[model samples]
Target chain A: MISIKNLSFAYKKKPVFDGLNLQFKAGHVYGLLGKNGTGKSSLLRNIAGLLYPQNGSITVNGFTPFERLPVFLEDVFMVPEEFYLPDISVPDFIKHYAPFYPRFNSEKFRNYIAVFEIPADSTLQNMSYGQKKKVLISFALATNARILLMDEPTNGLDIMSKSQFRKILAEALDEEQCIIISTHQVKDLENLIDRITIIDEGKILFDENVETITKKLSFRFAYDAEDVAAAIYSESSLIGNVIVAPNIDGDEGKLDLELLYKAIITNSEKITKLFQQ
Target chain B: MNQFFSLKRFTLLVLKHWADNKKRYGLSVLAFIGLLITWFVFTMLTGFDNIPMGKAVQQITFFLSLFAVGTFYASQYFRDLGSRSKGINFLLVPASAFEKLLCSLLYSVVLFFIVFTTAFYLIDVLMVAIANSLPGTEKLAGKPNVINVFKVIILRFNSDSTINFLLFFFSVQSAFLLGSVYFEKYSFIKTIICGFVAGFILFCMMYFFYEHLLPNGGFHKGFLTSFRVHVDGVNDHLVQVPRWIGEVFRFLIMYGIAPFLWIVTYFRLKEKQV
Candidate 1:
């Protein structure tokens, strides 16, 4: 679990997070969405203790994240947007690095690597970027850290690797784990993240549980002019004008993340008010 | 299991560092040996007639190789921190800052000296043996046992001065290590520039204060020298720095300088950000 309160972070005079408050609880996969330079990855770095907040504090799993004590670090792992794997074989990397995490499951690591299809003896530098990302993802999951922070994890992955990543992440997660993934590719995370938090202009524009979102908001096509006017957010697709409207009834439909993202971004005030109510 | 300083963790960190850099390090060792052998042979062929293959040449070679390789190693040990890829990997490793800093000291200070000394002697002993094996060259060169060569080099700078010299080497090496952390790129060159600029400024300040401002303080190189100031129509006044102050300066040079630089290096590393 992570808690950030009144966190103000900036780059020199350029501010990023201005008194932003956010929390991530265990047993949920969090999708962090934002436009470029909106502080999504910066938020993840703050939670991972990589970057210190200028004001307030970040608490991860009951410990101050920035202290970076071995015990604190053992329970937290971060896959940076731009990451590095040493110039060593995958097995050698694991051999040299895995001991730091007491709960690291070597078996799980091997299984994840098997699913990713990376060669055991191959040097990491020889692998493609996507391949290296897969290796890093596998290693991160195997660490069994209570909190896992990933930035643009699916950026370099092929279509199939992305799907494989979603599957392994879902399978590897436990109730005690909290995974916060910052990415612009929402489709890669469909049916994966349970909670969505969208940030814009150094503030959390939208944060809600996917289940609660589906329960309160209806994502469907507008039937006519009245429906189009009544809809909170809508866009014209090949079939019709798809809309996101308030679901007053108990009817439940599939959550279209991309559409939901647009709805929240456009009608952020109304949507936020609805959630508050 | 100790968080701050664990012997097990330290050992693991050292091994991990080695594993990460063994290829480059091993190759550097080989290259160092080649360079040493080549330089020795070249110097013997070219300069033997003028300089003579005596204790002086041997001492010069030892000190030259020692400093060249030592500074290079110190400058490069933390060079990985310059790039984000390597820097991130290094910083994120689950080791305390103390452990990480200690690991660097172990490699740059201890292991570098031992390994470089061993390599130098190995090459020197073999080369000296080969040179002596020839009929006429036996008298030309000293016998090539590593211990004898060490004695010759050690005798050149007496033991006390040699210890001070090594301490001074550490002070210089510590500055380079700090530079490796200080500058993101071109750490070696940047460190040299910083040192040169700092030296220039210090020299200027010393000239101004000691020569121009300190009551006619033209440096009289004596234990307790007095300066006579022509105080503009007044009687000439004598100003003397006490012997204790001079001893203080000597003590600082002998003992305080390296530790002070090391502390600065530690704080610099501790404050290092990605």
Candidate 2:
């Protein structure tokens, strides 16, 4: 569980986040959607206690993360976008780092490593970037931390590894743990993330469950460029025109993320009105 | 006991780092040996028989040993910076700033003092024995004994002058530590510039107050007079100032400035975009 209130941050007199507020709870995979240079990583760092917010407060599991007590540290882990492991074997790293985490499950770590096919004898520094990310992810999960913050985790992985990554992440989920993943590749987390939080212009634009999104909006395909007045947002595709229709009829249709994003940006007033109704 | 255990962990980390870069350590050791050999050969060739080798060794050991300390300290700081990929691991550890600072200071300064002193004394004894046995350098050697070296080390520790020297060394080291945390790039140079700029600003403020402000009767002369008297009264035979005040000042400056810099650094280091 996490709470951020009136969190504002600036760099060199330029505002990155202003009065941003949000909350997160356990039992859901959150997709932190945001554009480049939109303070996605900055927000994640603030939550991880890596960087302190210039103004406002952040509480994680009833403790200020910046305090970084042993109990808090043991229950929180962050997988940074750019990471390096010391020139030590996987086993050696575990041996040295595991004792710090009281709930560290060495057996689970070994199992995940085996399942992921990571070499036991390989030094982490010698591994590829994607491989190292996997190793860190596996180790983080094995720590049994209640809160995990990951940034751009699927950036360097190959297609197979990406799918494998998704599978492992899904399998690693539990009712007590909360994972906040910030990434641009929304498609990679299509079915994995249960909730979506979109941040733009230094503020959260939308925060809703995927199921709620599906029930509240309908994506329809049109054959021609007819101005369907009922359509909240419409875009032309090669095969047809894809349109987002308000869910006044109670038609439960699959929510097209790209379409929904376009609708929220281009016709925000209409979308907001529909949600209000 | 907590401090001791934390120190042990710090030592382990440093050893792990050294093990990871054994080649660099080996190169440094070879360079040290080469320097020692050059000094030894130069003394033999010059026929400097009047110079007491023991005293010369002690002097060289004291000064050159600082080089070992300086190099190790600088390298450790740079190495930690270079390990940015793993920076979060070190930064996020559940250790207080004081614990981390003490561990770093002790491992680099105190440990280096112990190890280098012991090893260099042994090397000095061996060199003296070899010089005494050589045909051309018979007068170059004195009584080669460990007791004399131990006496020199013990006497150095007991001397009041040594305490003042250590205080100054520690003060400078504290400044460097603060510098290490202040600037992300070229921290050493930035720290030096910052020190000079701060000192100059303080000097200018004092000069203005004494020259202009005091002339207008804006301040009390008794304050300045008392300050001068206080400073003069603290002057002593061995220490330039009373040891207690010097120690208190050192502790206050180091503890105060180091943590402030560390907190500034914590806020300054942002998460890099990938």
Candidate 3:
């Protein structure tokens, strides 16, 4: 579990998060969504203990992340958007790095690399960006870290690899682990993430589970004027007008992440009122 | 496991760092060897024409190269911390900050000095053997023997001077080591510039205090003490600080600088972010 309260951070006077409060629980894949410069990456870094908050406290697994104790580090792993791997073979990287994590599973790591189609004998520096990211993702999962924080893990992956990533991530997650992925690309993780957390201007605009979102709101096309009028948010599309309307009858539908993000950003008050009831 | 210090974790960190930098380090050492061989070949060719170079030439070359390249390697010990990609990987490693800093010190100070000395002597012994074997070189230079290079170098000067020189070298290297962490890019050049600026400032201040402020002072010495007298003859005499103070100054110069800079580097690394 990760808990953050009254968190404030800035870079030479440009405040990123002010009095921001948030929490993350285990056994769930959290999809952290936000527009550019909305502090999504910064928030993840703070939670990972990469950045120090000027004010307030952040605790992960009952340990202060900034302390960076071996006990704390062994349980937390972060895959940043831009990462580095040494110019060594995959097995060599494992030999040197895996011992730090007591629970690291080398067999699982090898299996993950095989599933990702990255050759285990290949030199990391010679591989492409997508291959390296896959390797890092594989290593992070294999570490068996309790909390996994990834920033744009799918950035360099091909379409096929993206789906494979989602599939592998879903299978790799243990019941005790907490995973938080921060990305502006929402659709890539649509089916994988169970919770949607939208942040705007350093504050969480909306945070709820997929079950809660689908339970309270219906996302589909409005065929008529009445349907369009009932939508809390709408946008024109090729088939018809896509709408996000209150599910008064407790109906179920796919959660439109893109539309939900747009709704939360443009019509936050109305959406908040809808969820409040 | 103690968070501040752990022998097991420190050893692991050192091994990991070596694994990550094995290629770069290997290449650097090989390059240094190649450079030494080249210098030896060139010196032999040049000095063979007139005075067949003896131990003095070899010693000069050895010490000069040792100071120049050794300091450079020390300064570049933490170069990976300059880039965000590498810096993150380095900082987020499970080892404590103290371990990380100690790893660099181990590489830059202890390992570097030992390796550099060994390599220098290897080339030196080989070159001297070749020179002694050649015709018409026996009378020009001393007979080649496998001499202990460390002893020869230290014995060139008095023990006190040798100790002082070693201390000064360590202090300068420590400053450059700190610069490796303090500057993001061009650390060597920045350290050089800063070093010159600081030296200039210190020299000017010392000159001002001794020359202008002291009013034409002249040294007056006794058996166990010394004093400086003001030309005005108003008994404005300046007494030298106690012998303990001098001893303390010597101790600081001999032992204080490296660890002090190392501690600074540790704190700097702790506050580092990427």
Candidate 4:
């Protein structure tokens, strides 16, 4: 579990977060959505204790993250957007790094790497970027850390690897773990993330569960001009107007994350009002 | 299981650090040995007639290379902290700051000294033997003895110049280590510049205080503790601290500087953000 209260953080003169309060609980994968410079990675870094908050506090599993106690660190693993692995073989990396985590399962690591199709004896430096990222992801998951903070985890992955990433991530989750992924590629996380926290301008624009989002909003193409005009957020496509409007029907529609993200970002007030209601 | 200083965690950290950097370390040591051989061979060919190949050449080579290599090694120890990805990899390792700092001290101070001294002696012995075996050189001058590095003297600056230089080396090396963590880029050069600027500022401050701020008194016997003042007619008054206090201060200056810098380095590491 992580709790952030009135957190204010900045990089030198440029302010990132001001009085931002957020909470992440175990057992759910949180998709942190935001524009390029909206502090999505910064938020994840703050939670991981890589970046210190200028004001207020962040408590992860009853410990101040900035203290970076071994106990706290062993339970939290971060897959940074830009990551570095030592110029060593996979087995050597695991041999040296795995002991640091008490819950590390070597078998699970091997399984994840197998799923990712990365060679066990391959040297990390000699591998391609995607291969390296897969190795890092596999290692991160196998650490079995309670809190896994991933930033742009799918950035370098091929189409198949991205799906493999989603599969392994879904399989890796448990009731005692929390995974917060900050990424711009929302489509890759279609059914993987259970909760969505959209941030814009250092503030939480929308925070909702996938089930609730599907129930509250409808994502569909509208051929009717009136429906397109009345929709909360609509984009004109060649075939029809893709509309994200209030889901008035009782039947739950599938959640379209990309469309939902756009609807929230474009017409946040109406969408937020609908969610509130 | 102790969080702050777990022996298991420390061992793992040391092992992990070694595994991560063993290749680079191996290459660096090899390069150092190669450079030493080249320098010693050059010195033998050019300076054998003028410079004594025994204590003087060995001693000078030992100290000069020690300072140059030692400080550069310490500066590079934490250079990974300069980059965001590497810094995150470093800091997020499951070890306390104390353990990390202790591991750094182990490599930069203890291990570096052992390896450097071994390499120096290895080259020193070979070079000395080659110089002594040279045709007609042994008869023209006394045999060139291989210097026992521990016993070599430099200008009689202290009872044991080796020990003095070793302590000074640690102090300067520790500063460079701190600078490696403190500055993001060009840490070695920045630390040297900062050291020069700080030394100059301290010199000016001391000169101004002694000459203008304080009464007309000049420091004499030992570090700032003994001063002589001149009255118009009376014998120049000599003021000095108690011998015990002066001895303590002296001991601290010689031994405390490295650990002092180490403490600063530790705190800076704790405060380091990436």
Taken over the whole model, the C-alpha lDDT of each candidate is 0.83, 0.69, 0.85, 0.90
Model 3 per-residue lDDT tens digits across residues B63-162 = 6887798779877987878987777787778888888889988998899888888888787788778877779866753554554545555564465655
lDDT of 2 by residue, B1-274 (tens): 2522355555545554444455555676567666765676676568544442446555555555655455435434533543545667665554544445555555555765565566566666667676666664445445433334333343353454444444445555555655565445676667667779989999999988777654323222232331232234355122144556666765665455545544443333322211
**Compared with the true structure, what per-residue lDDT tens digits does model 4 show for residues B72-148?**
99999899999989999999999999999999999999999999999888877887778778877656546787777
Q: In order, what fnat does every candidate score? A: 0.46, 0.24, 0.54, 0.83
Q: lDDT tens string, model 1, B34-76?
A: 9988877887777553333445566677887787778878999
True lDDT of residue A254, candidate 1: 90
In DockQ terms, which candidate is top?
A: 4
Listed in order, each prediction's TM-score against the native is 0.91, 0.79, 0.94, 0.98
Please say which candidate is ahead in TM-score: 3 or 4: 4
- Cα deviation of A90 in candidate 1 (Å)? 2.1
Best by lDDT: 4
Give the TM-score between model 3's chain B and the true chain B: 0.88
Interface RMSD of each: 1.5, 4.9, 1.0, 0.6
TM-score winner: 4
Determine which window of 10 residues in candidate 4 chain A has minimal summed lDDT.
A248-257
Candidate 4 or 1, higher DockQ: 4
Local error of candidate 4 at residue A64 (angstroms): 0.6
Q: TM-score of the A chain in candidate 1? A: 0.97
Candidate 3 stretches with Cα past 4 Å from truth are B48-50, B141-159, B212-226, B230-238
